[model samples]
Target: MSFEKTWYSLNEAIEKFGLEKGLILKWIEDGLVRAEEIDGKVERVNVDDLDLKVQEMTGI
Candidate 1:
């Protein structure tokens, strides 16, 4: 609910989630969040799923 973007890059998610980049990558590896390849190697985060996970984790 605090985020405004519909999509986020790995780096952006790191900043928004206030977590380390490695942690975000770990989430991707752990299937906590899904990443979509936008162009070549670049990826976009599914903000909706990320938001839901945040809410679940924070009990918001």
Candidate 2:
């Protein structure tokens, strides 16, 4: 993975994590995943951050 890539939309993140979009959004709101609001609507999660959480949860 490249360091330059650091962002993901709600849907993209869902597919990446194999979780539902609603769950991803809930995680964001729960302060589990860092997110930024772009275009005043879209939520983008840091790809690196998402990966970190996956590793933490699964120990893989």
Candidate 3:
């Protein structure tokens, strides 16, 4: 079967979604999206949660 990415680094999410870093960070803080710290340094975003938010924002 094929595999799909379930998570993305903060920078990757920002680049892929064309969203500002601060906005993404705020989402994480507001619990609109989920994130996890990797190696106690990099924060990875939950792709599914982010996609849902995008859909809500765009009404698509």
Candidate 4:
């Protein structure tokens, strides 16, 4: 069996990728990725969108 994550909380993304919160927020604001607000507090980002953004930024 294999498990893969399709969405990640903002905090999780920051911690897991060592990325800045402001940058992620900016990405959200710029409509670069899709995000959903959970419990009106936590926000989750789409893993596929984030990966694409990272690849674009890193030129990888």
Judged by TM-score, which candidate is best? 3
Candidate 1 residue lDDT tens string, 1-52: 5656688987787778776777666777789878886564538887777778
Q: Please report the TM-score between candidate 1 and the true structure.
A: 0.64
lDDT of 4 by residue, 2-59 (tens): 4889789888888877788888888888999789976865479877788888899899
How close is every model to the real structure, measured as TM-score?
Answer: 0.64, 0.69, 0.85, 0.79
On the 0 to 100 scale, the lDDT of residue 16 in model 3 is: 89
Ranking by TM-score: 3, 4, 2, 1
Q: Candidate 1 regions off by >4 Å? A: 1-4, 38-42
lDDT of each: 0.75, 0.78, 0.87, 0.83
Root-mean-square deviation (CA) per prediction: 3.7, 2.5, 2.0, 2.3
Tens-digit lDDT track of model 2 for 1-60: 556767988778888789777766776778878899967665788777778877988999
Q: 1-60 in candidate 3: lDDT tens per residue?
A: 549998999999998899898888888889999999768654899888989989999999
Rank order by lDDT, top first? 3, 4, 2, 1
True lDDT of residue 18, candidate 1 = 79
- Choose 2 or 4, whichever is better by TM-score: 4
- What root-mean-square deviation over C-alphas does model 4 reach? 2.3
